[model samples]
Target chain A: MKVMVAGGAGFIGSHLIDALLAQGDDVVCVDNFFIGTRENIAHLHGNPHFKFYEQDLTDLDRMLKIFQAEQVEYVFHLAANSDIQASAQNPMIEYKNTYSTTFILLECMRLCGVKKLFFASTSAVYGEQMGVEVSEDAVALKPISYYGGAKLGSEGIISSFAYMNDMSVLVFRFPNVIGPRLTHGVIFDFVKRLKADPTHLRILGDGTQSKPYIYVMDLVDAIMRFKDVEKGITLYNVGVETQTSVTRIAEIVCEKMGLPEIPFEYTGGRGGWKGDVPVFAYNLDKIHAAGWRASMTSDEAVAKTVEMVL
Target chain B: MKVMVAGGAGFIGSHLIDALLAQGDDVVCVDNFFIGTRENIAHLHGNPHFKFYEQDLTDLDRMLKIFQAEQVEYVFHLAANSDIQASAQNPMIEYKNTYSTTFILLECMRLCGVKKLFFASTSAVYGEQMGVEVSEDAVALKPISYYGGAKLGSEGIISSFAYMNDMSVLVFRFPNVIGPRLTHGVIFDFVKRLKADPTHLRILGDGTQSKPYIYVMDLVDAIMRFKDVEKGITLYNVGVETQTSVTRIAEIVCEKMGLPEIPFEYTGGRGGWKGDVPVFAYNLDKIHAAGWRASMTSDEAVAKTVEMVL
Candidate 1:
């Protein structure tokens, strides 16, 4: 099948493209490189089955033309401004990159008569559900950050489009995904910070913040596992059931970089920054019932990500 | 107190403005008059307490100037394209009127340091939950129409703004609101159709489509009752618990028009239009528990609206 990945030059998207190509599927990759980087997709320079477009998904006319030209059957919408702290300063980043992008993509799909879609939503949509293991069907979705709000808004838009246009949509609410080619997160930030200063490390918040972290391959596997399900609108929470703490991640990074004796300077707070939910968990009963689970735990994922990035 | 009522020249908005003025509050009304009319607020021409701006809410620059100039203490955001069928035909109408307008208004409020807000949401956000009375805290919000989707998106935006800016927001998910200045709905359409041809009345759907109809004044009363609740984010279903059928509404309109023997021509379908949820109900338990309730029933509101319009 011919597929289009909206953020195909980014970390997760690049890996997804590699998997799609290995499976002998023609992949049309589109990205504006706002959060995505060309280096991620540099390996696929001249692959016959891969096509690349340096285009903004929010531009409906151009996207429509690509859909018409490519005759793309499926869409994996992963393009978004993933930086939560930056969006806290200016909410328009989330509005444009996350919310409006989804609207424009859905409109393009509707106009082009494309029906199949896989949207990359976030667990941030659950907001500060600290102790509760939030399910796909959790009663209230009150997002704290602009990014989370935009993702939630995008999901609402996708749901309406699915019902109105008879489209089959699969939405995955992902937790912290970590692996090779990781662009940005705690692990990446820790590694970068440690390299800048070997003896002292600055931590944003109290080191007690913990959450699940799934490997990128595990997430890609989960997507491929249930991509064929032709449901009107099916949502799943994708993540490892286990969690790893920020301090634990710091230890893993220090050990990997041969700097285990580095002192950890803490910025005491419940959250790392404004609009941060310190901790949350996903209830994976629905996805587990569907016969797909992550092969690595959060700690293992974090450790491996440290090893690869270092 | 000084308050800004967006879309203040429209049906429900005009009534809200009147109530605000009666309560001795200075009112700043803004409307582009797309769905609103000049006649709705023509009587307030000489009232010093009332100020009007022929402005579009989506223009952030102009709205910022309006907010700064008005020094608005509170905002009652009733601006949206309420026409569901029209939005179904063109989804951008909802995206622009409902979703983008809310984002701009919230941004304006943030910039101007105006905290309190009252938003007019819709039960369509609950989607097609047949026979189930959906509460504000319903587990899954899967809107079926473009209008509902956009409204739901707006709610998500509002939630984020409330959290990040420490603002208080009151979101009221309104059902079918009918009253004297009503511009559209089944009752209004039925009256218009009967007037166009007294011998033949064309009713959309099977005419068995039943839902709650809250009178404009009753809805306004509910808003005024809970507007001062300075909660971070409080959502309420503002509607009468009782419901009325479309056929019953047609009968009521005919009787009110003194043409009770008019033939009712039914366009048979589950929903009146493509994106219509044939039947649903609002769970008002939360609002009722909060010591507030609608003074009118759905049937009574419908009957009264018919009598007044005729």
Candidate 2:
């Protein structure tokens, strides 16, 4: 199979590229390197089957040229400005980076006669849900932040395209994915802060906000399984069933670093900052039924991420 | 008051500009003329208190320059790509025109130290609702189209800005605003089609989809009242309380045009198009308590709009 992974230089994208190559598929990795780094996909440079293109998804003509050259059969769209806090401050950047880019990719796919697309959505799309476990069928989408809004907007566009253009789409709403080579995550932030000072970790929103987490490998596996499923338009919640509080993750980071119990300070607020969702958890039965499950708990994922970052 | 009306040469913006000028407010109308026509504001060109600037809001520097030069006290943000069908087909253009432009304007307003802003939102943000009267406090927003998603995304940004900064915002989610100078609406479309072919009127859907409608003048009145109300971030559903069906609107158009009752043809679908909301009616109690009301019924508004367009 010939596959294109947009943002394939980022953490999960790079890993997905590795797996796709291992399966002997011709992979075309495209990245603008906004948040993605070249180091992430450095290992694949020597492979004969692996080709990388430095291109921005917003430029439709460039993307179209790549599609034409590769004759791409499927697309895995993982590129985005994923910082929720930054999105609150600079929403236009977020909209351009996430929503507009996704639309451009979809349009390019439609023009090139691509049959299938896999979109990397976020659990942030669930916003502040009331239930402990949010199902794909449940009404969990009411994004509080600009980042989440852009994701939801992208989902709407993808669904519209799927219905109108007969494009098969599988949207994976991943919870906080943490793993090795991650450029940004709660565990990575904690590790960086400890490495810098090793004194106190300042937590946002009282450290009580809890959310589900998924390992990067687990997310990639789920994406592959959901893609194989013959569904017209499938949206799934991809995450471990266990929930972890920010305080718990912080403690796990300290434990992994072999440091003394540091004093934790809280920024007293309902939300971490403007446009933050204080609490969220997802129901993973949809993807689990499709023969995929999370092997690591949220704490385990955080610990592993801390080890890799340190 | 000194005011800057973005997209002021467009339908609702032009009406709002007229109202602002009649109240002796200094008005600066900014437009890129994408969907806005110069003829809408050509009459006000000679007024000493009214000025016009042709500029796109997406250019932050240009928007900032205009804000500083105009000494704008209040901002009426009405610029958007208004076609829902077009947004469904071209999501990137919709996101750029609707969401990115809004963020740029907000940033420009913040830099210019503008304290108040009025955002023209749409009931399309509600998507398809089961209730007869949807309220402002609805739990979830599942917009089917890129245009609605962009509107909802802008609303999120405005709410975040209000929460973080000390900016006051009033978001008016209008329902099918129709009146004189309107470029696109059911009434306008019907009038144009009947003029071209007097015997047949083609409706998009099954002619059963109902929507709440408000005359543009009444909408302007609601907006002015909202501006006077001091609030941090207030959202209101501004529309006539009654619901009007497409079939009834066709009848009204025929009666107003003094033509024979045209054969209404149903295209057989759930909505006007793939991303259109099949039915929606808003609850205007919040706006009514704020001392504003639409004097005309939806049927009356449709009849008046047909007369004006004809």
Candidate 3:
């Protein structure tokens, strides 16, 4: 089978591409490198089954040409404006990159007769659910940030398109994913900050912000495990059961960086930024019921990510 | 209070404007006249309390200028592509008229600090939830039409904007709304078709497709009752509990037009159109709990709409 990864040069996308190539599936990687880096997919330069396109998914005509040319059977739509805080400052970024990209891709897919899709959604859609495990089916998805809103918008569009066009869509609502080729996150931020000033670390929020962090490979494996789901709009929450705190992450990063005695200073608040979701926990019952579980815990994933970045 | 009613010359918007003007509020009406007509708001030309601007809500700069000039204290965002079937034919119609309008309006509101908003959402956002009364709170919103998807997207964006900018938003998920100045829907379609050929009436679905139809005045009343809600994101299912069938609607239209013995021909399917939702029921528990109710039932609303249109 042939597949196209929409954001297949960035952190998780690159990892997904490698896994697909290893499994002997023809892979087409498309990325404009807005948040994605060329270095991530640098190792796959001369592979036989791997093709790459540095193109923006928001351009409908270009995406249509690619879809027509490749005869792409399936699409892994992981493309989005990944930076939540950056989107909070300039909402047009999320509207154009995140929401419009999904709109254009769905239109292109419909036009080209593609019938299957794998969408990477974020748990940010379940905004500020405070003090309960958010399941896939329950809880009204009221995203606090522009980024979350855009993702939720994309999900609605994808759902409608799937139903209207007789297409099958697999939407995975992911928590914070951590591992190698880490571009952005609290882990990456901490690593960069500590590298600059090992004596003091400035954390964004009050150290109590806690959430689950799934490993990149584990997430990729979960996506691979459910690749052949020929259902109409199958949604799942993919993450480990356990959670790690901000303070715990700080401690792990310090230990991993060999700077155990670094002083920690916090810009005090419940949330790190204006649109930040202070805390959330995913109810992974749906994905777990599917017989797929993350191999690493939140702490374990954070620790390994720290080592990889360091 | 000074309020701006977007799409103020359309069906429900005209009714809302009349209500607002009757209650001694300064009304600034903005519309591009896409589906809206001059006849709807012709009576308001000499009224000093009501001001009309023929402009598109999708233009950000113009909307911002209007916001600054009118000092619009609250916004009743009713602007959208009212024709769902037309949107199914061209998805970009909803993208530009429905979804982008909301995005631009919210941004203008945010910039001008005009916090309060009353967004007109729909039951289409609920999609095909078979055999159960869908409340405003429960059920994952998987809209099956481009129109529904755009409305749901607007809801998500409005929720986030309300949360992020400390604004109060009142989102009403309306069922089929009927009565005077009815631009589109089954009743309007039946009346128009029967006028063209009084001997025969053509219905879209199996004629068994049923859903609640709220009267426009009653819906306007509900919106007025909750206009001052200072809460963060107050959502309500605004509709009558009773449902009217498509065949029943056709019969009503024929009777009103003095052609009661007209032959009924159905296109024969669960849905009238490809993205059409066959059946849905709204749980009015939330709106009832908030001390509001629709005065007219579905059958009465449909019958009355037939009379009005004829």
lDDT tens digits, residue span A167-226, model 2: 778888887787877877677777788889899988878888787777888888777666
lDDT of 3 by residue, B104-151 (tens): 998998889888999999999989988878987776988999999989
lDDT tens string, model 3, A114-144?
A: 9999999999888889887999887688998
What's the lDDT for all of these models?
0.90, 0.81, 0.89
Interface RMSD of each: 0.7, 3.9, 0.9
Tell me the tens digit of each residue's lDDT in model 2 across B25-114. Answer: 999999999999989998997899999999988898888888888888899999999977666667767767897788788778767778
Q: What are the candidates' individual DockQ scores?
A: 0.80, 0.25, 0.74
Ten residues in sequence with the least summed lDDT for candidate 3 chain B: B301-310
Pick out the ten consecutive residues of candidate 2 chain A with the lowest summed lDDT.
Answer: A137-146
**Docking level for model 1:** medium
Best by lDDT: 1
- Model 1: runs farther than 4 Å from truth? none
Error of 1 at B309 (Å): 2.5
lDDT per residue (tens digit) for residues A1-310 in model 1: 9999999998899999999999989999999999899899999999999999999988888988998999999999999998888889999888889998899989989988899999999999999986788988897899988889989999998989999999999999998888888878888899899888898888888999999999999999988888875758999999988998899999989998999797999999988987888988889999999989899999999988888988
Model 2 segments more than 4 A misplaced: A85-92, A126-144, A196-210, A228-233, A245-247, A261-279, A283-292, B85-92, B129-140, B197-206, B228-233, B261-274, B283-292
